[model samples]
Target: MLGQKNPPVDRGQATAIIVFILGLGALLPWNFFVTASLYFKERLAVNVAVNMTLNMVVNGTHAGHTKDYNFDSWMAFLSMLPLLLFTLLNSFLYQWVRERVRVAFSMVAILLLFSLTAALVRVQMEPDTFFSITMATIWFINTFSAVLQGSLFGMVGLLPSRYSTLFMSGQGLAGIFAAVAMLISVLSNADGINAALGYFITPCVAMVAILACYTLLPHLEFARFYLNRDETDKQPIEKMPIKSRDKTVLKNSEDPKDPEAPVLQDYKLPEKHTHNQPRLSVFAVFKKIWVMAACITCIFGVTLAVFPVITVKVQTSYRGYTRWDKVFTCVCCFIMFNSMDLVGRSVPSLVQWPRKESRLFPVVVVSRVLFIPLLMMCNIPDSKLGTIFSHDFAFVVIMALFAFSNGYFASLCMAYAPQLVRSRDCETAGALMTFFLALGLSLGASISFLFGYLV
Candidate 1:
């Protein structure tokens, strides 16, 4: 009773926190960019400097003066470019680097640097240069961030399936948080520069938090239990008593009576390998889940091609809500899409709709491609295309479907892929899925450029 030692930290809760942080950090930048679309457009939209004065300076024509530059033209491509290219490259990059923690730290540093640079651009750069600079920063930041995302997904796949689910749900939270922030800023009529500064500052703080959580994970007792299991498996069975090894089996605090090691529910570690055997090829794993890969690719491709690029531009035809009208439309749509997407991602845990192996999965994926054209038809300014679903309420209905389908299908694809292959290759399968996810984003972003021109 003289001196008492401190209680041990809870590894289970710590691991959960880290997983949530990883998921949230991975998508925070994206949420901010999409949620803040209206703010960026207002500040960076092409100036109304139509010419004719002093040999084509300021314009006399009201029509010319009213026209704004098509600001969405370049950003649609830049936003998704890195996700596509770097995700493919990261497959090899991850293999080359043995220490994931180091890479995770590096990613945090890069995100912080980019966020700082974004703030600087707003302060130091001229208005004319804002669009180009902002686009370039987005491209660079996303390119590196994709690596971080791929790494996070791989790590999650290596853990229990619930961890992956937790990660995805965290992404939904990021969107909701962003939507709320933007809504507040717009309604409060917050200073444009101050609001933009908050946009950049928020992610930097999150990356720092993510880095801190990652640093704590390796040292936790519960985490070490899993790592120790991996170590015990590598030891020669002849040297280690089977009973002795069983004694070390990890037990969760919630299930103290259970003696089993905490391994992934869907995947089991392979039996001990003989010295003569070679390891499984990454392609071998990919071959098993090619259908899943295709499904995920098409899912993200269709989503990235249209989302903030096209959806954000779909203005409300309603005259009732005119004050901060663009901001209202953008924030409302973002919150609706994000909230529904969260529901979609979470649904797989309760029910896996359309079994992973079903032929209907691909059919479902291809059907989603129609959302792009359908969303495009909604109240896009200056487009020759006749508007049909012009009301904000109608657009809201379609967008909810669009976001829900994307989150549900993408989550299902990821969760099911690990189950398709051998247990050891689950990580590889997850990484490969991430590659396709990036590919889809890239493909969609590229298509968004064409849509931009047409609009």
Candidate 2:
């Protein structure tokens, strides 16, 4: 039976855990930025005058300023540039090397950089250091993480659909974990230094754990099974040993001590089948999944354009909710979105609707652009015009829907992409898909800046 050569189904649970962890680690850098959002608003000066004053009298524009400068949208936009550029570069290089190599390299770089950055932040407690220095560190960490995520998701695409689903769910989990931590910090009335330390401690611990997982992954029986499948697919028939009447002679040839291999009786090399199943070119894979890629790009782009920047800025006009406003706007929204997103991603494991080959996926994705207007109409600050969906409840509901759709559509696109091409080119299809994801994030981040001004 063909079942003899198939991977054991029992290994699914272990593989799922590994893929989930991989997804978690890949998105941790971004999570670090989001979770530490409060620190940025507090420590980094946005106003030129405040920066000058801090620089001359205190540590140059590095200390916490009294005046708050709305830098979220601009920070989102600026942050994506390096990530977008490096994702493309990594995607291009994927055509030449294995995804594991790139993933490993990026992971090591991430660990070292984060360790170094955390140490610098700890030692240089003076608020006077250049904000540019901090921004530079953030940018580089994001850039490397972009490459790491592209490679990791691409690798996941080569596996079963459930792996990619779990991977996405893990990303949502990171957001949930972060949101909960921030909420706890707020409730406990932690000082600024203690709060910042919380953010630093979480990643340092997570990164170390992730590094151990990566090291052990290759040795896991579950991981090895999929890797073996990949190797089998790439090896030609001619390279395999031919059946022989003199099994002893063939066995002798395989022995490392036998410098001169013995000729086996009634053995002949297998014929190569090059005419069938040629590898798909990168562009060909792109064309096959361009619509899917577009859906991913648009989904992320629309999300990046609004979230935390525009959506997080909107709060109730009530006076009593002032103390909890930041918590409600930033932390609660993130938790709601992340929870809904986890549900959305998990749904595909049970039901893969609107098949990847169907035209409906892209249509559904494009329709999401409508959320842009809907979100903008919420109770935003300084708006003279009244909105029908002005209430906080309505905003939370919309955010839930927005996040759910994002997870569902993104998971579908990624899981479906590799299926469109030959097994050998699945990774390429994945890398191409990751490229579009970055493109979407970049587009959305850029659009966020404009929306910030408008809001």
Q: Of the candidates shown, which would achieve the greatest lDDT relative to the real structure?
A: 2
lDDT of each: 0.68, 0.71
Residues 424-446, candidate 2, lDDT per residue (tens digit)? Answer: 67677877887888899888887
For every model shown, what is its TM-score relative to the native structure?
A: 0.79, 0.82
Cα lDDT tens digits, model 1, 1-455, are: 11211113334578767777778878877677766666667764423331223224344333434334465555556767777787777666766774365356656656766576556635644445665667777777777677778777776765556667778877777888888787777677667777777766777777777778877777877544443323433432211222333222322212434444333232222445732234357788778989989999899889878877788777777657667485756465778888998888877777877987688888987899888889889988777676888777888889889998988888888877876754445556777888898788777777777776666
Q: Count backbone clashes in candidate 1.
A: 1
Clashes of each: 1, 4
